[model samples]
Target chain A: MATGAEQAHGAAAPGMPQLDFTTFPNQIFWLVVTLVVIYLVLTRLAIPRIATVLAERRGTVANDLATAEELKLKAQEAEATYEKALADARAEAQKIVAEARAEINRDLDAANARAEAEIAARLAESETRIAAIRDTATENVRAVARETAVEVARAILPAAASDPAALVSAVDRRMEMEGGA
Target chain B: MAVEDGGGLSIKPMDQFIVKPLFRDIEPGSCMPPEIVEGCLKWYEPSNVTLWMGLGIVATLLLLVVGTRGRAIIPSRSQSMAELTYGFVHQMVEDVAGKDALKFFPYIMTLFMFILFANVLGLIPMSFTTTSHIAVTATMAIAVFVTVTAIGFVKNGAGFLKLFWVDAAPLALRPVLAVIELISYFVRPVSHSVRLAGAIMAGHAVMKVFAGFAAIALVAPLALGGMVAIYGLELLVAFIQAYVFTILTCVYLRDALHPSH
Candidate 1:
């Protein structure tokens, strides 16, 4: 085969050296060696390492996704908590306002009741003083009418002046009739 | 061989495909003819194929091993690329070959990384494309063929032969279909290896031809532009061919695992 290849190469034009059969053994030998080296490197080292790296990457991605999901859930839970707190605060503030309003209304009602009672007492005292003054004025007017009548009778007749009792009785009878009218 | 005589341009595009030993003590511009296998290129000789393949292995290790050495859950840029490749091939194996084929993940991953690195690395200027050689690709393909076939037989025994026997066909045409299936089955490795080597070789050869035209002063700019355009295209082809090869491998593995359809 080597001689045949050499004879073929002896030709003027060697054509495609790839067709030269002599190099086949060398190429095949090295090819086998290269393939075996590649196979060993891959099976023993390269493939496993790359496979591990890939599996790790996939796992890392999945883990990241899971972490993101967890964080999202936690954020939703916090938002819900915040909403409940806000609602509670609002309700508490409303209750406090209502209580303060009720207290203010009670104080106002007490103040109003005290003022009304004091006004009623002052009115009753004023009425009693007016009644007493009216009583005194009525007495004074009766007294003046009696005295003026006596004086007029005496001036009209000297003998009549000695009979004051009869004059007094007539005056009393007239005053009584006026009072009734 | 690039030749210029009497202002006439001559470029041998295929000369670049020559598999010569790197340790040539010969004079510059003169290569030891491949016929002198005595000290020229022995079976164990360190040729350009060895160097590039070694580079491919180093690239494989750099991407897969050292890139992920951080083992960080949050990967670095190179580590991310490493992980992306891992997931890409892993999912491909699982999806195309089935979950039962997960045990073969390492093997599939090896092939994918090796070919992918080799293809991409070949794009470097002045670098030898190890995968462009039929001998190299054929070896890998044959290995896959043998391994998959062995696994099929070991797992399914005589039932593995059902792969070539299409039961869905009409009973009258079953034998004819079986013959076709059998031939196609045997041709899998040939097509597989050839497809990869051919794609790489053609792209590289075309680039070389375009580059050769650059020697002419008149169309130099056009040649350079074409080279740039083809370079961009070859970059795409580099990754796509790797993907195609790996996917086809998965398909073949699927057949081996099931061997019914």
Candidate 2:
């Protein structure tokens, strides 16, 4: 019967149907068929689909990584350019400050030199005028003294006959003595 | 085989492994004509083999085919399981065999899933373990063996014979070592098949014996506890056996692909 192998066969190891040789052919046949079918399913359909998903994921990841790298490089270049521009501006500002400071100092020095020369010239002129005035005043004083002395002599000495030449020589000799002292 | 002892309790421990026909009725001499018996022996006739094998296929398709039908980026539970299985086998095949051997990934994947599902399915109550039979395991093992041999010859031609030649041994011992190696090499498929079948058959038989002892009221508690423990162990064994079989296949494939002495 078809059921004979699936059914019980009397043996020493009574319940162990695995020892039965009768049912082997059927199990083996079906196992081959089942294994082949499963293999087909995996190769033709299931595994290929899985591989596709995996490969797609890998490709997307790699592409994303490449894009990220390019963007990073671009950011770095931008940062470098910004830093360069900043440095240039700072240098230019420093140069401008230095040049303006030098120009201001030159102008200030020129103004100070001009003012000192003018002040020196004014001081020399004032000294010259004062000397001239002193000279004039000294001359006037000497002349007045001489004239007063002569008039007084003429008015006081009416009895006595005065020697004019002797008087004049005496007055001259006195003036010379005072000037020498 | 039930035996009644002095206590009058009988147990048939080996009754579970029976391979009964699922459909045909051939009760001894009741079929007076020999033609019916001859008709029943035909290979194409469906039996318990068809039922269990069909169940394994159905389970595989449900998990793989239907579960992955959506192919969602965020997988459902069954889809996750399907992906996990795919990745696990894929990594194993790639790591154990070289990347070149991934060409045979489908075959290795099929074997792993089939054996794993078959072993797990056998754990159900009153279910027949297809892997427990030598016929089925032997067939798979022999197929692997033939495939590896054919690949070795096809890829390496006469150079494949160098795998048997032991240049590492001393000149005097080379022949002796070659003979020894050849025997063991030929014995690989036999051991591969028997290892799985024997382990599964032994576990089921031991559990059956324990379950049979559960009939005795005095020892029922102890027997049930033991059965539970053994059942747990069998679950672990089921997965380990499948892993062992698959890894060994990878090793053989590596040998065939690279067959250098």
**For model 2 chain A, the run of ten residues with the poorest summed lDDT:** A2-11
Say which candidate scores most in DockQ.
Answer: 1
- TM-scores across all candidates? 0.81, 0.71
Off by over 4 Å in 1: A1-13, A63-87, A119-181, B1-4, B25-40
Q: Against the native chain B, what TM-score does each candidate's chain B reach?
A: 0.93, 0.91
Error of 1 at B165 (Å): 2.9
Writing each residue's lDDT as its tens digit, candidate 1 over B120-233 gives 898898888888999989988998899999999998999999998898988999999999998998999999999999999999999998898888878889999999999999
lDDT of 2 by residue, A1-181 (tens): 4234324333233345675555677777788888988888888878887777667667878999999999999999999999999999999999999999999999999999999999999999999999999889877866776666666678898432266555656676787799799
* lDDT tens readout by residue for model 2, B144-206: 999999999999999888788888889999898889988988999999999999999889988
DockQ score of candidate 2?
0.21
Q: What is the C-alpha RMSD of each candidate to the true structure, in Å?
A: 6.0, 7.3
